[model samples]
Target: MTSSTPRRDTLRFITCGSVDDGKSTLIGRLLHDAGAVPDDQVAALRDAEGRLDFSLLVDGLLAEREQGITIDVAYRYFSTPRRQFIVADTPGHEQYTRNMATGASTADAAVVLVDARKGVLTQTRRHSHIVSLLGVRHVVLAVTKMDMVAWSQDAFDAIAADYLAFAEAAGLPAPTVIPVSGVTGDNLVRRGEAAEWYAGPTLLEVLEGLPPIAETARPFRMAVQGVNRPNLDFRGYTGRINSGVVRVGDAVAVSPSGVRSHVERIVVMGGDLPQARAGQSVTLTFTDEIDVSRGDVLAAADAPLEAADQFEATLIWMAEAEMVSGRVYDLKIGARTVPAQITDIRHRVNVNTQEKLAARSLALNDIGVCHLSLGQDVAFEPYEVERELGAFILIDRLTRATVGAGMIRFALRRAHNIHRQAIKVDRNQRAALKGQKAAVVWLTGLSGSGKSTIANLVEERLTAEGRHAYLIDGDNLRHGLSRDLGFTEADRVENIRRAAEVARMMADAGLIVLVSLISPFRAERQMVRDMMPDDEFLEVFVDAPLAVAEARDVKGLYAKARRGEIANFTGVSSPYEPPAEPDLHLRTNQMSPDEAAEAVIARLRAARRLTASPPFEQPPLT
Candidate 1:
């Protein structure tokens, strides 16, 4: 052992492989042999075979043992004289790949297991690729059940070579491959004579001999978690140092704003510290009273964090709902939460073949390269530069559940170049001249649901009353703006996107824009809502049952869709996700188009978008 190098107390690692690969047995043997298990637990270790039946795993995980599945991640603890270790036992099934990523996110190393009979399976490649993506520094490949193969070195060497090649292509570090029998406890804690041909170190020796992380190599970076102001005199910023170190008098800067200051004091719980390194949560007081907020980042002055509003990232879709391009989701990056959208999906990776395949969206457990546009500029770095600053989780606005994970590769080259040009006459000024609050009245529902008729009536009434107004129908847009797009999922998303943009432009020109379209997905409508400010966008759902709409197929489109002539027709082959809480709900089934138009007019008046009354104070339509 290299005693000169400082050792860390715990090595957080994980055991991951295909199902029935002896991951549980390997961990059980290691824990028992390392003297981490209690005598009482050992008494109940074996099954009817008088052998270690590690078929049962971590506590609270026995409920799944009957099914021989690990649905969630289970953390197990063990120790040796050299160092203590925390091992995450992760599920290996394909559906639970997200759970595996959860365990590997914080792990320093991964013990990738492979059954001697199965060699390297798809799960092996996927787990290893995720490990590489998550920045796990080390890997120890344990080929378990060596007794099944009679401890053949040739089989081990062949499997090792294949895995090494795959890992190299997948951007993973070369792993240490060892042959071991989890059932017989061979070559786990000590070397047995089974594989005399193998002259390398045993499984435990490799892990014990591996060097602990002893580098504070990156520039200092700490995202301000909160502004600490207990009393009047003490106003310090509290956060954990993500990298490097900071001491008193050290020059530092705030990100996204180039405000520089010097560290006056570093205070911990007990007292002030001379200096604080990575992993230390300390309260820092600066010499100058600088502008700081919850989402701000404090960093070394010479190496301040970069800020960007657009980025290129790799996304791992975890939610069952497929990822939709042009949809707005909340992306939490370190201390900051920003409204983010996947502007484009460049491609998705085939984990087994390591091939890049063209894709419009990412499904559950699918990995894709995507472009993200944030609502505002944020301090961040590439994943290779710093994990804490580069990694982010995507949250659904409605459900508030984590839907996806992303690693920032780099900011888009054009993100820094393209800046918003200022216009002297802005939206508010234009709206003031028109004497109305310019807004987009979006009408959404099934096809042939009277959306277009209501929108037309509303447009005529507004224009007749001397208010400048515009109507953008989805079918009319196909004539030019979205002519090239088709009826596929991606095409529909683009169609809606184009209509929303046109509505936004018309609203900017001081016109009340009325949009009539069957923007199928709720996410697509939400994207439009995000594009405009509050009170400037009104979602008017022309509610109608699918059967009612199909019966009233004025354009015969629904009849064609039912005949299987149209592949992705919404309400037939494709799905239409209705708005859960629309700003104005007009049930077309009970009300005529005239009444629906009147209701929309009333809503517009109530919302103050239109200060003028209708053409002649029109009576209720009969």
Candidate 2:
């Protein structure tokens, strides 16, 4: 089913940028000039005495008033006769980056404020990155405080040029830059006469002419947000229709369970509705007893939904905590929450320059590609096709905090894959089988410094001691688990991520897992460690000199690395900073293999991980 008409008349836009960029002042001017604000509010602005304490107009929070900054995303509703506007004034401080994300996440367009005096700063680039990442279709780079630069067209042009260059590099469409004086009410709703050199539509005129939200003609797709059980006799699946249309008597498919049935009835908030189109929140009753619940999307039989356990997505890391691979978090899409693990990080985008940075892990406000695997198969549509079903949020299970936001690019697994294993055994039993408690043993070192060899030795020793053990060697893992990975900084992050997950699973089974990886970056290694319990995790450093490592390169990786066969390769092409603190350190070059193994054994014994005595210890009895 499809609906060709647009339902909403108004368009929503958000203003985002670093603090003191005059976002609030610009918004206030727009509202005042458009006659959207009430007479009383206008009087308040005038009484505040032409100084235009713009923060007072929209900064609703008392804390915001005290701090003279927008603390939260403040929504201001106003309308011109031509089009309605709902403006979200987002915070600018780096600490409130997540708040900025929350604001722009739903906007059709964004007004990215840049100080003309300061030009484009790092925060300006960051906000632009976030706007593009969030799928904001239109961007207006409102260069504020032209009065600071004496409304100089040359100054405005210079800043505009710099921003344009950066935006092109960041993969964002060239933004329309308007040189405006927010405090003086120039080039906002009304074109001020000050900019004599410029002959362009005013900011409000441009905003008013933006294309209305386009309607999609895709098949009927609605994700069940909640089960509406008003009484014992009535059972309905409630959610907003993501695309197309839904009507009674239409054949539908329930995913990921894939049960087929006919739509018995369509119900709206008021009562039974004749039909529901995209963007309308409604409920539906099916003819058969399908095992449908939250997280499941219903689609027309003609265009059935695809089910997959893994998918690739573009993500904006909004948390202070870095995005590391193999870390498990709850993914919330629509009304569904599923356990998810990041298998790989593809690359980080440099927003201003639109260049791809080789990133291992994404810090706060970083944008990257990630390969994600759900705990179970779920139905999803590509973001380009259907944004409602494709967008997701990563929530930290422990803190219940949203750490990242994602948009599905494509599904990795097929719908009919039956190789997926269902949860059967208890975790306690699995842990008992492994000798040591299951925990992630994160190994970080330089390439060719013996991390893999030492990890192999450790695993062998644990296995011989009758303990279950698993080895997630960095190289071997890349063959299958991270086969699609590369050696870029971002790729390396994903590589460690997949390895970390395998290690996490082994550790959960109470296995003495050894991860021998030259996880050169400190931030990435710490992320792996954070995923495991304190007692179970061991950060083992395989310390050796660059010369020693190069001399012992059996794989010729060092040789190739020196010749630059690989870029961002640790110890050769890239820098490898050894861990300042580690659970255990073994100078493999100084000590023999046996001596190094004994040292590991000694450390494990001291940690109460092993009962075996050192070789020097002898039995006193008999």
Candidate 3:
């Protein structure tokens, strides 16, 4: 005898597409027809003009109502006699694409809406690709607003064929196409009489019939979140099980350390459990006193996970600041955190056309294939195999803000191939050979703040006094090394990174290196400070108010910014963070350029950065 598949009781899904695709209306209609909406709440959905507006039900925010658009992901719960449903109505605007990704991250299915009049748009394709990337196997292409097209079968067939072709090209599972009018309730609850010739299941029928996604059969994995010891009587490791099942006597291995142990007991809120399955929150008591702490993964001993420090991943840049290669960030997966960097960008995918485009950096909402190198080995699995162990977020270390989301593909072999090479000639030897202390004088300020002028004067004064000095001006280097970069927040970070690296190299060669740049972000400046020894880097804040800098727009850049001809311009469109406690502060309004140079020279001498044995002479102020 054959057995029948079990019926799923709950469905999790999201609605996404281009702006004004009737997603809100479709959800509101579903809730209303299913009697999910209360009578009093239904009465409250009317606008000031007293029009029957369904979208007012879910557009709950004041900003959303005023703008007449959804800005954030809004979740709604409703149920039918056969099944319960949780719907995430994600914003369709291009700027809020990150929020859509966040909503789709946990969904088992997706309802991608498309306006019958608009057909398939760029956002439609973008949302489809994201749903596929997130592992949502079941998809519904809701061709909404069928009443506008007179319920024409030809129009519906054309869109369905186009989407199927796109799905094939993008390697996404084909979606079930449906013709419905969300506003008029055609083919929504029960098939309306709008289309007489068409005979298909209603939207609710298709949704209720979708099978529940099967749980992964992979070996047990749990990230240790906390060590619980109410008293000396008992000790347990507390965390939510990520995959598979664990029993009381199950043998386990701690990853990244390779420690082996056996579970003695499993404790839950109710009591001790003989076994715990995936998604259950429980604590386990170990039979042995092995070393285990937070940020460590405990897995089934039979199938230990791979420990690696490097992997290739699909990255989605989420910050307004673009992504910069070679910059370290906090890579957080489950409970573990490691310092990581995107070493290289291989390519970016064009969502609208499904084409691969070469890219060096990723901007906001950009998806690309990149290489990540971690500070230490971590237990990981490919996202296709296990989501909790493979999905991660990139956090800006200094700002303590999330900047990107990534899905690990696989570990790379070249990670172990690269090793640090040591040399006999160190910094001390290089400094001794030049007969002077090596240091980097970092100058930061707003545009036209006299930083470049003061830096040029300081370098000239040092060179005339028989000392080796070099000036790494920001603008001059931009014409060469950073020529490919722009004024986005991410590019600004890279610009400073390249300049600081060059300055460090010159300083290592036993020369005084002066850097003049409008390094606006405090985080970037602090990163540069942490790169060298305590006394080797000095931050000089060339102070000038925004009014003063705008008045002295030497290149007419500020004027262009005010006229909307330039964007991300500091003190205009973007922001500039001044140093909180600079090593040297120069108020250009109160001191001449020569006076500033002399003050810097005096400070260097006091710090022992210059010795008198070299027969140094001070340059005249004139």
Candidate 4:
């Protein structure tokens, strides 16, 4: 323990699958083959008799023992002369997906087991998708129970090909697939006669040959995990160096405050060191008196670091509730936790086919592209460059539960772009000048059914009353702001998304904004609501029967849609789901336009949205 140099040859791997996928048995076989298990444990397993008592080796939990399945991620430490190993046996059930994510979060590689008879199931594809999403670069597709299929090469090859195709379609990096029989112990530790036709290294041989991570080539970055104060004279910042190398007297910058400092000393727990590299947990002392604290990261000055309040990222939704935009959560990155919200859902990736789908909200176990706005600027690197600093987890603010995992793709605002702009009036000042608070009035209705007309009328009235109002008319916006957009379900969703976000910015500037378009989807409207505050969101359902809307079709869009010239056009080729409940619903066919406006204005006043409206004067009874 006192040696100046500590042994640094540990391989962290995780075994993941759905329950009854034989994860425990595979782990037991590996431990037994590697000679890592104690002699007593081996003897017990051999003497236990009946039904392959392999569970006795690692299933220490009483629930696991009785239930005959792993309930939690079990960690087992073992070592061979060449390398040390830490294996995490993760649960395979759908309900335990979070547990599997936890177990595989920090692993350098993952071993995904598939039952030979079951071939590739939904869970198999799910686990593969998860492994890739979690940034596990190396994957070993271990096809278990080959003996059940008589060690048939064709069976193994077919499964392998299917999995490979699926994985490719899912955008997962290519994985190495190997067939093995855990029960008979063939091709686990050594090559066996049962797999004579199989021409690959045994599992142990492949594992042993896995190259260790190249820690030195990366950029220097160490997130301050905690402060160490052994004594008054020994105050130091302790953290694991996530990437690159740090040496004494090396110049480093502390982000996101961007404080420049030099390393005074590097202190390992056992001894003082002149240098420290990635993966080493050491305490660093800065020469200058700087405000360095937990969550701050030290990085090389040449490359510096990326710190941003907004970022574009890829997220894998793990929660049961769909990922709604603007919902605040605690983002845990490295050793830091910061408030964050999903500003937008760019698109969702189909895990099975790797196709990008326009998604309003990400469902459970869905992976998607999202724009995240952090409460404060945070230091991050792209996952491709630095896994430790680039990856983060989203925790529900109230429940303190981890809901999603993410990887930063690019910083929205970098350090160089942090300079203050030269503007006379800022956003707050602009809001104050508008008299009435700015907000988005998202109106949804069928084509030619008075959405645009009402929106334009609302904006005109608000402007005439000295309120700074803007109308992001759906058609007009599509010609400019959303010019590239179309009318498909996805395109429509995207169209509304762009409009809502722009409306939010304008509203933040104290304008009363109105969006008038035929946004016929309920989900799309809900997405807009999520992007704004409850009071700020005003959903007006312009209720008109399809017959009326088509009758008044000045653009002949309804006729075109009926003629199959357009696909997914609401109320003609596509289905239009009416709002079950809305903040304001107006039957345009029965009421005059002025009466409808007055009704909406009355509701807004009741909600305290209008500034100068007299105390709820009843309109003259007609």
Candidate 5:
């Protein structure tokens, strides 16, 4: 007399595969059979033979419809009698890694499609690995277009075997496999008389019976998004609990600070709460007046979060611009944003082959293991242990674009081992001893722009006035300081980093450091500027036209660059990002080297950096 009732829980899943693997078709077909698609839409989607074009239901973008390929992530909400579904039809193209990542970031489960004829592919492996990284709890291998292969059981078995092996190696859970044909509507929502050898539940049956995503039981943790001080009467910390549970009177501690506190009230919009769990946003009032601020994490008192400034992580490069080591980027983990740099790309991962390859830089869609160095200590756990505290995004500092996404593997041991040594003497002391303010004069411009000439003149003038100024020429740096560096954009970034560090060190030693380099990128120069004190680093733009600089190239560097001999030559091949607002701009072609040097000295005097130096006499132009 009793009949089984179907579960009604919603499942968020993504459909991803290599291009033309029938990802869109499979989704559309599923929706159509489930009776989720409107009759009008289905009628409009019919092809010449009166057969429904199942791919049209999800590929809603104009470009996607024109090209018949899913360009963007198309999210569709549909439900069968068994279960409700939120499906993200992700792109299958190679360059759409960013789009795939965006969709995979939130999905609890993933449906990886494979063409029956094509078998397992490179991108199939890549998407599988990414979804695994994003913590997709469940996976289903959808072998689409089974009708194309005449519903062959051997072909389905072979593809399943290949993918399962790869999944094991790539640290993914074994996926549920299903053979389904979009055209025939076989083995998708119902079992058609196509493959009697296959004896498994339909795709819909497996999905309906699947268990809910379970979060691992861990110590309570929440990154404080802000302190809610509505008025003078009440003050509470506000954030979503990243993991574990929190209750009133629960013993808690602030991380990286180790400050102890107890929860007084779990405040929500409805009023006081006795308890709160992970993923719930609430305002937590502390028993004590704890010195808690944004970017700080609250955790269980007994099990505080691990604090580190260096970590080895798996990075997925999502930007068009290649990822270069030693270039600083903003690492946004939870509510915390810190200046972080990929110190070294340990190795690039071959997603398809699962091989480790040597790599200095990672291009778009390249996955690599990188050593990250942060500006300050941050609270975190390994990504395997917890997703919320470990996953982060790399932001390009200048553009503020999210360039990469990474997951913390673990903290580097040496990060805790090395501490800043306490010194008796400091920068101010050294500057006072020298009786002049320490500074870095960074001269940026195109090559053959008389930067070295201007630097030499300025240094000579400063030294004559008893100012201990040091000149760091670009050519001279390559021979020693940056000998290992080349002219690639990544290399150029590192080169400027080394030069700026050396200049800072010299400046700290009470020397007026004059650094003359064709620092092409404005972002790199900005990085150098941020390393110094306010107004202490003077950006001097040595201006010169491309034709003038090329004509003035005595070493034949520009000619070689133009003739396809020398690579990454500034003003010839490589781009030069001139400073938008320079402390001083000198037209090298308009002024003699002496005049340019005098102008710099004048600017420094005006800024009070040349307090001890007298006015320099400019030599007459020949």
Candidate 6:
């Protein structure tokens, strides 16, 4: 092996393909051939006959060794004189597709192993699609098992042609197809006896010749992880630069706040520096004291990224649960974490066939095109332009688990269309004019659960007390405001969303709004709570047994739902996720509607939410 070359650069790549495609063997062979593995470790990987077992070198986990399958992404570091390398050996099973994605996220290149006998399997295309989706521009199709195919020229050529066609169809750049035998160490570090017809650089050669990353030419962007203020005298904004260069005195903008300042100093571990470039983890001192904190993007003033809340994106559903539209997720992109929701699922891609099929939800390992609505406008770019700025991970708000990996395609046009218009008369001014505290009491439960009856009673009592109040009844809203919505899960979420928004608006207009709806989904209920200010929104769970509601189905709605005539009807076809904590929990069976309404009024009075007159002046009792 040639080991003498200058100007070494580290290239990060991952090995992935269908099961038993020789990915771990390929990486292990590279390590062994390059003298990266110690002599003792090499000895440990040998069988009783003293022959090498290449998979043993990389599949170091006990379970992996026993099962002979990779369960986790095993990262291996090695180097040649020309370049250093970080090779990730990813699993091939569909269940571990998320592990493969995690490995490929930061990769500069991908080596997708294809067994000559199997040709292009389903997972081979899956890995290729994911590699391209992750913006790994350099791809190496390692057509392995030349020895098993007896070094047949036709076998290698056929597999290579099919893969090239598939890659081209998938909009991936043409890959460098190398015929190799990972088990025999053929064409790994050097050309071997196999594949006499093939005349191409070895896998290591291709990697060494791959283009070096040119981050200095890109726009300056850094994701702030923290504000390092060890003492009040010295403060630094610390983060790894994603792209471009930042020099002292350079004008910078901190987003999504859009605060602008000049870089007064650049501090590295050694001391202060004149400048800092991409990939370096350094701290920056700004000329002006700005609110530059964690989750903010420090970008160059001239070419800052666009701040947007809505975008069209490609998402890889990593969770076992399917994608739930309107469910709020904590989207962690770069160093910033924001509340985000998948507003729409346009279509899901059949990875094996590359078909964009209509889909309502994305299952595990499913790649889909969806629309995302973030809580706040933040700096971002299309993933093709900048992976760091455009890539994100969706975390489950309740479970705190990472559910999906996403790449922003582009900011939706509606992101620009929907701008917050500041009004002169705010909610406080409107509340002051009404001379009472305005709040929303959202009643939710099963169908025929006395929500409407209790809401009417509450509104009547409020009217008698001369309180400005309005009730947004569910059926009335469906007749006018939500007339177009259906009873599907998505439509139900939208229905409740519209109702909550209207209730919030009414409450903002100095009116106590009572909303009566069977908003079954807890996610949408929580979404509504998030829309209003704390304490302004009160969820009133109109509790009633399913049997009780079904027995009292005066309109025969529950009977229709049981007969399957009403599809997606809550408590029958769909599900009702009860709130873990509701402000008011009313057992309708135990209390009459009048009693429930009075109890709610009592709660408001106890919380001091009701307007109270001045107390009688007490006589001076010194």
Candidate 6 residue pairs that clash: none
TM-score of 6: 0.94
Candidate 4, residues 393-451, lDDT tens digits: the string is 99875567778988888886553477656878665566655555556777888887788
lDDT of 3 by residue, 1-622 (tens): 1366444367889999998999988988878877999999888877689855778778888988888788889999998877889999999998989989899888888999999988999988888888877778789989999999998989999999999899888778778888998788877787889888678888888998998665647689998998898999888899999888999889999988999999999999978999998888999999998888888889999998777899999998889977888677889988999888788899998998888899978888888899998878888888878878888999998778889989999999886577668887888777776667898999999999999999998888787776778999999999999999898877887898899889888988888889999999887888788677888899999998899888989999999999999999999999999998999999988898899999888878877888744445556547
For model 4, give the 10-residue run with minimal summed lDDT: 613-622
Estimate the TM-score of every prediction.
0.94, 0.69, 0.77, 0.68, 0.92, 0.94
lDDT of 3: 0.87
lDDT of 2 by residue, 32-74 (tens): 7787777776667653346555556787788987787887999
Off by over 4 Å in 4: 1-8, 43-51, 171-173, 228-235, 413-622
- Residue pairs with colliding backbones in model 1 are none
Backbone clash pairs in model 2 (N, Cα, C under 3 Å; residues 3+ apart or in different chains), count: 11
lDDT of 6: 0.88
Which stretches in model 3 have alpha-carbon errors above 4 Å? 1-9, 45-52, 229-235, 396-401, 419-521, 530-538, 542-577, 583-622
CA error at residue 63 for candidate 6, angstroms: 3.9
Ranking by lDDT: 5, 6, 1, 3, 4, 2
The 10-residue segment of model 3 with minimum total lDDT is 1-10
TM-score of 3: 0.77
Error of 6 at 302 (Å): 2.6
Show pairs that collide, candidate 5. Answer: none
Q: What's model 3's lDDT at 597?
A: 90
For residues 293-316, what per-residue lDDT tens digits would candidate 1 score against the true structure? 888899999998899999999899
Local accuracy by lDDT, each model: 0.87, 0.80, 0.87, 0.80, 0.88, 0.88
